[model samples]
Each structure stands twice: as C-alpha cells, then as structure tokens.
Target: MSQARPDHLTWRHRLVALAMGLSLLVLVVRMVELQVVNHERYIEQAADTRASGAATLTAPRGAILDATGYPLAISIDTWDIYIDRYVWAQDPDAASGAAIALAGMLGLDADQLMASGTSDDRGDILVQRRLPYERGAAIEEADLWGIRSLPSSIRSYPEGDLAGPLIGYVGLDNEGLWGVESDFDHLLRGQPGWVLHERDAVGRPIAFGQHAERAPEPGGEVQLTIDRFIQDIVERHLREALLEYQSSSGSILVMDPYTGAILAMASMPAVDLSAVGTDGAPEGEALAGSVRNRALTDLYEPGSVFKTITTAAALDLGLVNAESGYEDTGVAEVGGYAIRNWDFQAYGWVTVREYLQRSLNTGSVWLSQLIGAENFYDYVERFGFGEPTHIGLSGEAEGMIRTPEDQDWYPVDLATNSYGQGMAATPLQVLTAINSFANGGLLMRPYIVSRVVTNDEVRSYEPVEVRRVVSPATARTMANLMRDVVEGVEWHGARVDGYTVAGKTGTTIVSIPTGYDFDTTIASFAGFLPYERPAVSVLVKIDQPGGDVNLGGQVAAPVFAGVAADIMEYLDIPPSEQLVAGQ
Candidate 1:
C-alpha cells in the first residue's frame, strides 16, 4: 500500500510539471508576436501616450520699415496664458485659491475662473493673450501648478494710424491679412519649426525626459519707399482738409516720378491695427473707409484729371500744338448728346493753350475728333489706362473703359471720355498715367517697396518703365502747357510760393445707381513740383464734400499746394524762380 501511494504522488507531480511547461511556451510566443511582428505600432503608441503633439513653435514675423529705416509695423514680444485642467482637478482646493489670486491679478472674475479650473471636460484653455512680459513673469513667479505662459508677439504700429491701409495687420496665428502684409506674406512670414516634448501623467511638460527640438528660422525685413516724414505731413493736411471741407473721405499720394518710388500714400479715417472691436473687426468710420487702400482700390470718374490723357494724346498725335486755335461755344454736340462746360458759360475762339487754361469741354471734343476714336483708344491703352498697374498691392481695381469694339460703344462715349467722363479710374491709375509727362513721356511702373533686407543679402528695386507713351519733346511740350496752366490766372490757387508746380484738376459728378448725382462730386487734383526738373508728383482727392465748395480747384487744389510745399521743404528742394520765368 505504501509503494502505490508514492507512485500516485509521483504521477501527480509529473502532470503538474507538464502543465507549467505548456504555459511557459504560450507566454514566449505571445511576447515574440508583440516585440517583433508589431514593433513599430507599439512604439508609436508608447510615444503618443508620452507626448500629445499639441505644442508648436512659432517663428517671428518680419518688420516693416519706412524709407529712412523707421519702423512702421513691428513685432514686440508678448505672452499668452494657458491652463491645464487635469492638474487643477487633482488639487481642487489649492487650484481654487490660485484661480482667485490669478483672477485678481488678471482682472478676471474669480468665480468663473475657479469653475473653469475645476472642469475636467476641457483639456486646455487659453486664459489670456498679449499679456505684458512683466505681468506674465509675476504669474510665473507665483509658481501656479496648472498655469503655463508661452512666448508670443503682437504687432505694434509706432506711428499710430499713419499709413494704416498700406501697412495692414496680422491674425492671431501670425498670418498676414491685408495690404502689404497680405501681398508679401510669404516673404514676411518665416518658416516654423517643431519640438517633440514628453509630458507627465498630469499632462505637464517633463523637464528631464526623451525630447527633440528644431529651431525656427526668423523672417526677413521689408523696407518700403514710403518716407515717414512725408507720410505724416500728408496725413496731417489730409485730415485738416477733410475737416475743413466736411468731406466724407480723402486720399493723398506723393510719388517720385523718376524712380517710380512711392514717397507717401495717405488715406483719411485711418485705423490702428492694434485697436479692434471685441468681435475682432475694425470699428466705427475706420471700418467703412480705412480698411481699404483707397489710392489703389477705389475707382471713380477722374473728371478733368483725365484730360491730361486727352491732351497728351493730342500733342503726341501731332493733331494740335500749343499755338493751335479752336472756337469754344462752351458746348459740344456728339451723337445727340450735348456736353457743356462745368460753369455752363461761353468763351469763344481760344487758343489750344487757353483751351486747357479755361478747361473747355468743346475744345477737348474737337481735339478728340482730330485724333479720332481708333487713335484715341490707342493712346489711352498706350498710357496704361483700363488696366491694372501690377504695383504689388492687394485689392487693386482695374478701372473700367469701354472701347469702340464693345457692345456699349457710341460716338458720344468718345466725346465724354475725351473730357474725362463715361469711364472710371483709380487714383493711382490716374497718377500713373499723368506721370508719363513728368517722367519725359516714359510710363514708369510705380512701386512701394524700395528694398528688402534678408540675413544673406539686400535686394533693391529699380525703376521699371512700362512703355514710352509719347516723345520726349511731346512730354516737354505737354509739361510746358501744364506749367502755363499753373502760372495762368485760372489756376493761381494751385501755385506754391517761390516754386512753379504743374498739374490739372477735375470735379466729376459722383456716379450712383441712376445716371449721376450732380449734388455729390469727386474733387481731385494731380501735380508735380519744380515743374522743370519734376521731382515729386502729388495726387489729392476729396469725395462728397459739403457746402458750395465742391470744385476740384476749390477743394483739392489748395490741399495739393500745402502738401507739395511741406514735401519740398522736407526734401530740401531749392525753389526755381528763374526756371518759372523762363517757361
């Protein structure tokens, strides 16, 4: 009986050993499958568990500088406060106290912050943006467990509302939104990088752990042709003129005729990019007119300012000379449409020079008849009309022009267009076309950005000629005629003391859903200083002025004189009295 019991115990021990061996074999197979067959999958899962990949490093945006290295739009270091709800949930009592303390410092409601800190559904929350460095440092020194502050920046316009439409603004993600900012966004916005950081159990960045980081590349700087002093002077006079004339809006542009560099582009009702409504939109009157770069974007009937095109065509086509004579009855009949002078009066038998001096519509139609429709359209196209200037600006509108080939063609269109009507043009387009005379009949491509400075190189923009619209002699003749107009008694208001300036004025009836509004007019004046040398060309426009002072000579001409005088003084341009007398 003792031998049988020993044998039974031995068999039971052997069965237990066999079962343990089978269990060990199964465990080894499962370990091999996980470690070798699906190694990459498990590795990625472990990495994801340690790091959420939620954080990103933002590169600094470039600075926008003025002609003399003055900062117009700049980026200043700022901080953003964020909250991690998981850490706060772990210590409700302590987090509540911290929330109250933080709320006091941040000027936030304590109860609301406390509730936000206690919530677990929200993983992370942005508490505040654009917090001052000093204030954020104070919060960090307090050693709040759940709160973290990240380095960021906000755009600052030091000049404050000056050249607002041109400098434009950026979004929260550091993306450019308008004007030059939008036009040159890719160059201004630098390349962003990434960092792979491990987190703790409570979703906090671990100081000592497996991590990787790639540094971001900073953006380059953009230097514009805009002169800060000139911009300020232009805006000051434009603001004063807007108030004095009680006009709804106004714009002024000062350009270098030789280099095609824009010295000053100012628009009234300017907005500060740093100032916005709570809903993240531009507020008030600035919202309506200031958001658009009016000099390039908005279009209107150019009125007499366009007569420069007609006069240039007439002179270039050899259809008339300054000594040519025409009989002006104050009215012109074309295709059953009667076009009359602005004053609705008669001035009979005026020379070609007197035709422009008196701004006779009948004389302009007569010149158009001599040039004919085909030749007229040819000259207009050659002058860069009815087309975009491609001036490296966003929201540029190519003003409308109806050719003889279009279905809307009529003979009266020629007469009206000849006298600067029946068509539309942007202020920049008008200025660009008229610039041909100032630039010796060479149409130069107007540019705002003068240069760009990067880490490696400095790039400069040179004068680009679109085409030669007329002969140099013709341009000189046209300029001489314009100089005669400025020196004449009719344009005496446009003259600056001690200097002879040449320009033209236009007061067009504002177009509406109907035919036109005679009550509202767009008064504009375009002129260049030191007529003989021709340095700067100034264009001024006042929209919908109040009272009886609605004429271009009455409203915009004086403003041009004021702006021209200031710019000439700033540029140290010597007056040319001898040159004026010679002309």
Candidate 2:
C-alpha cells in the first residue's frame, strides 16, 4: 500500500506467504510426532531393518548312565554344512569349480551339489548334516565361497548293543524315538536358545556388530538301574546259548526281586543300536524281530512257568497244602478233554508238592477243581496276569486269560490254564508274577530308571509295592516247597553249587492254528538265588529248540545255573555253612 503496487501483484505476494507458513507449520508438527508421540514405533522399525539374521543354539541331550555311572548313550558336538545359492550364482565358472571341490571333500556327487547351490529361489540350502569333527574341519579348511558350517551334535553309543533296545534311540530332529528315549523325552531333551545379530545392507554380518543371545540349558541326566558288568555277563551267556540251542530266539532277565529293579535284561537276535539311524531301523540285522524288545511285547503260552502261579493260588486259598495227597491216573479229564503230564506217564499217588516238582498236568487239574473255576480266576488276576506291567516302555502287551465271565470260558479252560495252556502270557508277565514269591508275597512295580540328576536336584526312585498276594506264612511255606524242586533229583541241573536256589522248570508243546504241535516246544525256567535272602531272580527261555535236547531242564536250567554262579561270585555272596561243610 505504501508503494501503491498493482492489485494482481499484491494478491500473488500474499498467496506465496500463506503457502510458506503452511509448509513450516506442517514440518514442525511432523517433527514433534516423530520425535515424541511416535518415537518408539520408529525406533523399533529401524532396529528391525538393522537385524539381518537369527541363529538357533541346540541344547545337548542328557547322558544315559548305568548304576555305576558309565555312559550308555551320549551326544557329541558336530557340524552341519550349508550353501548360499545367491552367492554361488554370481560366477558360473567359480560355482562349478567349488561344487566339484566340495563334492570331492564331502564324498557327495558333483551334480547334486551343483544343483543345490545354483537355486536362485532358495536362499540357503543344506549341503550336509551332522558331519563328524574331522570331516567338517577338512571342509572348513577349503573356505570356498557360498560354503558355511554351524555347530551340532550326534548321538553315539560307547557300549554298543548293550541295553540297546532298552536305552532306545534318537531321531534326526534331535528328538527321542524309543525305549527310555521316548519315555523320558522331555527330561532328556534340553531347552534350545537363539541369537539375533546385526547385518549390513549386503546381508553379511557386520564386524563387531551388536548382538543378543540366550544361552542354552543342557538336559538332565538319566541314571538307570542296569548294571553294566552283570549285563555283560548275561549277554555273553545268552549269546552262547542262543547259538548252541539252534533255537529260533531267546531272552533272559535278571532282576532285584525285592525291588523290581531290572539289573540285566537281554534279548537274543539283538539289533546293533549303534548302527541304527534316525529312521529307527537296523541296517545289518533282520528287521523283523530286531527292533522290538520281545520280553515286553511278545506273548507265548508260557508252558510250565504258569504252574507256579497255580501252586501259589492253591496254597493261598487253603485249597491244598504241600503235604496234601492226590491220586494221579497220569491223566485228568475235563469237559471231555483228556490232559496228561509232560512225560505222559502216571506216578500213581503223589503229594501236592510233587505236582510242582514233577510239573504234573493231572495234579494241577485236580487242584484247580478243588479251588473252583471262579476262585482260580481270581488268583490268576491277583498274580498280575491279563494286564500290562506299565513298565514305562512302549508296545507293552497285556496277556490273554479267559475268565468265568467270558462267553468262551469252560471247565476245560480251568484245567488248561492251571497247567499254563489255552491262555497266553508275556515273558515279562511270567517273570513278574513269579517274583511275588521272592518278594515275600509283595508284588512290586518294575522300573528301569533308578535316579534322575538335574541341574537343580537329584531324585532316587524307591521300590514300590503294588499289592500283597499272600500271607507271610503262606509265602514262607511256598518258598520251602519250591526249594524241594531245586533239590529234587529231576532238577539237579538247576542247583547252584553254593546257593540254595528255588525254581521251576517248564516244557510245553507249541500251540498252532490246528492244535498243539507235539514236535515243537518252548523251554523255560524261573528261579531266585540265595534262597534265604533272595537277592536276584532269573528267568531263561528258549523258543523252538531243535533236536531231542529241548527240555527246560536240559536247555534252560543250565543257563540259569551259569548266570547265577557268576552273579554270586561277582556280588561276593558268601556260601552257606551247609554248602561249605558239604564241600
């Protein structure tokens, strides 16, 4: 107005000033919002852009130790190799040369490596997994482009094939798969950790860059009740017998009868656990019977091992005493089915104790009638048959028993079941049931793991009594009767030199689809040593042994003797005064 400028020029000047003021105001508002109101959001975004990579730290699996603290299964640090496809794509000639060189070092095919490293779609590709220290070190020395390695672990068994099936195995994902591994997987597998590191714009980790990491927690250790020394002895003798008998297969279990702690358990035709991979199959051995622990899973007629259960039931019910006399016509008829003893010969009149010593079928049938079918079934159930032991192992089977409530139950069922026929039981079940006598009529829950050592504390497992099957007096009387069996002339093969062993021998015809196969039989023996104290219980079983020497006394009893003799000497058990004086 002072200069008297034109009206259009004045309007243009005013408009320019207004636009400048608006721009300043907007800039100030934006600065305040970014620096104060939205400060945390922006900062987080910036940090996200700076963090280029993350890595996982695998935790070491716990060691499986024996009672003496010897490691059965352990994890060793290793390396895993990887290839960056984007880096290799930069140069064709260099990529080809690197692929060939890597293949030669890793014993891999050249074409496979080239294909793996030349993929533009995939960022990082696996070149190899779980390589040993020496092999990984050799590859690292090459230091080729696009090649890298990280730390890892591989499972190893120091004592190969010893407790192989029981210790179980791990999978490629560093997870437990079978046996104790599968049973206590959460306790054995430790917590995994992770790391976040800053990287430059080129996707390479910046030198001295900011990083954050969480340290991994190693898994707790597992202490088993297995005794390596005793296990070794059992395996040695079992292997010899397996080959000598020319039998289909066999198994032996040595347990602390009072505690139900398995000291040594061996299965013949064993799979080399060290040779097995993450796939859970053995490479060299036949896979049919190798993978499964037959003692827990397989069921057979049990033959004479079932007789002890019947004897204990009779004595507990007061249906028969050791001195009770019965007339044996060599055969007993039930439901029109004529059953005879193993010898198929009549001994005329014999005491009830002679029934167990001689393993008489007619005498057991007669006793079963005196106890009645209903009472007989109740006694069998009390002995823990027809159910799984819940031994913390997978694939445990419950044996079959026909009771009075079942539609198929008949009078003949009573006679056959009394003598261990027409019903099925697993080796574990037979062993556990017979163990009641040794445990002072107390049935205990069997367990393999004895202790667990964690970073925080250590826990020791105690013997758990499940139930009492008989009175203490009755148990003592039954023990005495079994002692006579071991001392009898027919069972002289089973007698230990210094120990008053009490056991029963069984030989029964194999049942087939058509009927009992008279030519084939399963031989078995169950006994406990140091008769007075009863430190250990042993069960030896041979399946389908060829030739005429297939009797339990001939094939299975000697194994019991050999194993017991070694165990007594190793344990430093003193011989009885009776034994010393006799010697």
> Against the true structure, whose lDDT is highest?
1
Please identify model 2 stretches exceeding 4 Å from their true place: 1-56, 90-116, 119-122, 134-145, 195-213, 277-288, 578-583
**Clashing residue pairs for model 2:** none
| Clashing residue pairs for model 1 | none
Worst 10 residues of 2 by lDDT: 46-55
Estimate, for each residue in 392-460, the C-alpha lDDT of model 2 and write its tens digit. 778889999898899979889999999898898888888888788887898888888999988888988
Please give the distance, in angstroms, between residue 140's alpha carbon in candidate 2 and its true position after superposition.
6.4
Candidate 1 minimal-lDDT segment of 10 residues: 1-10
Computed on alpha carbons, the lDDT of every model, listed in order, comes to: 0.84, 0.82
User: Whole-model lDDT for model 2 versus the true structure?
Assistant: 0.82
What's the TM-score of every candidate structure? 0.86, 0.83
Q: What is the lDDT of residue 200 in candidate 1?
A: 68
- Model 1 C-alpha lDDT per residue in residues 1-583, reported as the tens digit of each score: 4554444557778899999999999999889988998865565566556555344556777899999998998877777787777778778887888898899889999899878777663357779997887898888888787787766677778888778889888878888777788788887877764455577665765678666555667677999999999999999999999999999788999999887789999876777665654566666654756678899988888988777789889888887898998878888888998888888888888888888887778878988999999999999899888899989998889989999999989999999999789898888988888888888999889999988877778999988998899999999988888888788755467899878888888899998987999789999999898987887999999999898799898999999999999988898877887665666
